[model samples]
Target chain A: MSWQLGIEHLRDLARGAAILGTGGGGDPLIGRLLVEQAIREHGPVTVVDPDELADDAFVIPTAQMGAPTVIVEKIPRGSEPVGALRALEKHLGRHADATMPIECGGINSMIPLLVAARTGLPVVDADGMGRAFPELQMETFSVYGVPGSPMAIAGEHDETVVIDTGTDNKQMEWLARGITIRLGGVAHIAEYSMTGAEVKRTAVPRTLSLGLSIGRAVREARAVHADPVEAIRDALAPTLYSHLRVLFRGKVVDVERRTLEGFARGRARFTSYDGTSELELRFQNENLVAEVDGEVVCTVPDLICVLEGDTAEPITTEGLRYGQRVTVVGISTPALMRTPEALAVFGPSCFGLDVEFNPVEDRAETPAGVATSLAP
Target chain B: MSWQLGIEHLRDLARGAAILGTGGGGDPLIGRLLVEQAIREHGPVTVVDPDELADDAFVIPTAQMGAPTVIVEKIPRGSEPVGALRALEKHLGRHADATMPIECGGINSMIPLLVAARTGLPVVDADGMGRAFPELQMETFSVYGVPGSPMAIAGEHDETVVIDTGTDNKQMEWLARGITIRLGGVAHIAEYSMTGAEVKRTAVPRTLSLGLSIGRAVREARAVHADPVEAIRDALAPTLYSHLRVLFRGKVVDVERRTLEGFARGRARFTSYDGTSELELRFQNENLVAEVDGEVVCTVPDLICVLEGDTAEPITTEGLRYGQRVTVVGISTPALMRTPEALAVFGPSCFGLDVEFNPVEDRAETPAGVATSLAP
Candidate 1:
């Protein structure tokens, strides 16, 4: 299916993508405004399903890379992502048939739409990571055999760097990270160029639509005075992230965060309403692991999302505050993202976590008593 | 005029380049070995005068970037310079008519020779810097108006990055420096691509010949048991660096050096043989300032070269050691390099030194008594 993403669809998309960002991928608000302005100037962009593309369609994924905390201050000039795409296209000697998101989370989900709007190219309804991960090589495209090279990065001042080397994806991440830090802790990148067949085979499909669905559900729930958290659970019921649960509901007690090595890294502590139980969340740009009372219940490649207790609006890692009432939710990742190969790239061990990989559903089942405890 | 740079000429070239290196540009011996191996395998490279090139000739300068201290440990794989050259050529969509050294000092003088030998391309006898300076923007090509991008950088593992943007020379240096650090402390770069007319107008002409002359003078002086330091002064008498003076003769008492921000930086303190006065040489890769008895006697864009007291062998900052009997020498930079415009780019204050722009010739004159004091 193909659809048009107008300014009307941006709010829902940003909202949904924020939840999918897993507490990283930069602030969705900035992305929304940038996309809104780009669309207002260039018109709405077409969103094409991955299956609707011809096999030879050239698809390039675009995203912003660096600490989300930095993105809040050093907003991109909006032309950077398009500059990266054009630079890549010039290097490859071909125009891209469509643009896509490297990760269908946070600002990245909005980046492709901005690129598509400006360039009159359609955006594919897919992404490399169905949810966000901090590093470039964490993409499913890389795990499924896509080279991250011939990649182009653009800075706010119109500087463009093209890495056309034979380095493996991990080395690519290291090199790009170093450059991103130099580009004032933020850069726009167009990488993981692929054909339609490669996208169909490797990319997490329908992720854009999934984000929209999730965002719409939250918005609708808020309008009707229903429980937005429950609405989020219902929204994911039919998706790859089918298993969802509210790990904890509490007020944030502390947030120890710093922008380090081009990442928003920190830990947030939450105390239960009665102050009997505590939960701690560790993140590097995106939430990596969550522990309830010092016991691990959720970790990557599962989505650990922090949302406002009442509105269910996603709170990125950088947005976590000292006293905000919030709910920590964990949703199971897609089966393809949990395979041994995928796990080796973005699993708990990769983030230096001592725990082993355990799916959210298995680790924290929807207990009958807990499910009905939510305030309605 | 053109000349063949055979393997036999490398020793003289390296020795002369070391003197011109101003205690930076990496160790000449490493560059010598790399060039020697390349020539032995691929045969001699032809060195051509900048005037020999046609106006349309595409010329690219190549060099190694990073701390000289690191180059001593991480010897290049010998293919990086060529790799950078080829990558730049690919980015420009043209084959280079000739290769040239970005600087006539230290390892850089030999890098272009290696690239030329490997690619069967003739090297221009001119260079951007007649003597070495630490930063990429401190070149005549930049001072006289040549952009640094589209530049190419290549790592030991064949990783190549190309900067193809509108950034000015300083920003290009910053971007390239960040990438070089990530490339494991050392990388090869091909930059300042220009036409033959630009090369002829902007380059410090005949620097390779000057290095050869200085090397020959030192070698012959040593063969006959004469003063090699005086030979260096005599060798430069007819060149643009005509004002050469032996600044101090002393034993190194203290050396403080560290590899920081991809540069070899520190200060070496030398005491007179009789321990009457002290000379402090502050450097960032190449020596930038020489202070004698707390008075600034020499500073960039002049050459502050350190040499063995007896052998007159040029010693890079990385090679400075405690207790070594050394002579500090200052030579005037080219007239073009000392211009107000050039000074603005590479003058004393550029290195964060408090001293004003004073040429080596004006600061220290050759006293008749001091000239006669050299041991015969």
Candidate 2:
């Protein structure tokens, strides 16, 4: 059965999503409209719990992979993803029974809802990653040894490819990037084939609900004129909370962004409150780490979310500008990305930092309600 | 029927192909050896006449498209072209009647031969262009409105992509390049589907035979006391010989090469006996032009061939260096790429030259044998 969010929750959902999006999702207005349109056109997509999926349900996760700049220009022709999925099934000689989101940030999270409605597949209440981490292989799937190849990549002119390569996840990303650049820099892929068993084991189940809860908290916090940031802490309660850690955040005094060897790279240095201490952010999409002076204050598999402290709006790593009032808030990643393999790709070294990866729990206690995986 | 070429001819073929490769084709040694190995394995490929094929033949032309720098680093898996072609035909639901060389230079010229030996597809005698110009639309097919999008791009990882977009050839290149960059810079492609009728109308027919002739001319000229330049003149006779202007013969004083906007773009200003006239070479995969002394010397559709003035050993554009005594020779383009559509992509202006594109006959008269549409 479909569970609908009334108009009242939609604002909060969007605001909170923008926060969980961790600054990589495009403007929430467009994403909101797309989702609102999809819901309006096809009724609401039924979000089924991962437990509801059959053990053998054909589950595939989907997302748009490549440069974000390209995504804005090449408005998808609407049917490419569904076309890719059907093409994938045709190539595989079977249909997927369910679908999941590949990333929780940006339009990636809501993309599954539209795709699920169109494919008649239930949306798995889970995602490959709890927050964005740049490439396809940076997901929990890869850390868990899931293959990103043998998926379908489609172009608007109906060129659908069933891509299978011996390439490691990183290499496959390089190949698909050609299509993205050629298609004006964005490519949509239907990937991450799994059974319900695999999804239940590997995914950060119901993180959207977590996103929804965080979104609602921010909305409710604002409704009563409470601290939206504090509201987020309560909503993501038990998983994370507001902090008073004094790290400098103001205008991005300088930013250096470059895509080299297939990775979007660069760092941002900002001056907060007369530039007493500089706040620096190094990222490859979602904020990977924030540093004060020379020390890494926070790192990946943990959210390094920057919000307009007063407005609570998510700020992208690329667009971080000078003189913006930012509050760098950290959230522990959902279990999916916390795996060591995922960390190897998202952690300090991935961003060229020298710090050893420390679990989110080691640095800060999670709020009361979220499930925390006990360390091995 | 099979044609015969002695080792002497193959040597010249290799040399001339390298020179004609502009600066982008991989080192000719690889193509030469693969060919030598093929000759050693299954005998030399039968060089068919343009009229040898059936009228209803499905001709599939193929080549490599991406950054040349990435090619040598990521060696082709060799079996990729066949994989790309087979995939194309699988999509087309028919077997190809013949294979055509997409261009008559370095990596592109030999690729069709490789596919032919591997897939049992008969090789077409013609190529889409007589020499090389950068970009897919520079070909005779695109000049005649051929599509570049639906082409299959396959890499060493065996990752295969059939890219088809609604965008024109130029935009198609832009998008394909993104994927190419994503894929670590190089990939093999089998593209440009055409009927036998289309092949007859637009391609630079018998260009391989011409390449062989040029190769033989160089070898024979060097074997005896005859001038190697004269042999080159004879080998490239008729079509390419139309421009008999010898720009200069002196050691290169300076060489500079740079990659920009996906092209090996830079001018090699040379110190020649003719008071240092610079040779400007621009190539995507092949050299597009050779201008000398503030004059409109040579342009696309026309071949700008460079060689060691004394020995006739071909000098590739990218491989050109300081202290080499070289001669820049111009050969006219086939009528195919001289059309308005072709001019838009490969003409003088296409390469950012200010001069209008004129046939070689308008520029200079050849010694003899070189075919000129202007002569007819």
TM-score of each: 0.98, 0.84
What DockQ values do the models have? 0.83, 0.44
CA error at residue B136 for candidate 1, angstroms: 0.8
Report how far residue B299 has shifted in candidate 2, in Å.
2.2
Report model 2's TM-score to 2 decimal places.
Answer: 0.84
| Per-residue lDDT over B22-94 for candidate 1, one digit per residue giving the tens place of the 0 to 100 score | 9998888888998899999999999999889999999999999988989899989789999999999888899
lDDT at residue B37 of model 2 (Cα atoms): 59
**After superposition, candidate 1 runs with Cα above 4 Å error:** A364-376, B364-376
**What alpha-carbon RMSD in Å does predicted model 1 have with respect to the real structure?**
1.7
DockQ of 1: 0.83
Identify the candidate with maximal TM-score.
1
lDDT of 2 by residue, B1-376 (tens): 5464334456667666665564556555666666665656655566666677666778888777665655555667577778778767765667888788887777777777777766666778788767766677667777776675567777666777665554366665665565565566666777788888878877878877766667677777778868776776655556633445454455566666665555666666554454534555555445666555545566666666666767767676567778777766666665666778878877778767677777756774322212111111
Worst 10 residues of 2 chain A by lDDT: A367-376
Please give, for residues A157-242, the per-residue lDDT of candidate 1 as tens digits: 88899986564988889888989999999999999999999999999999999999999999999999998988989999998889
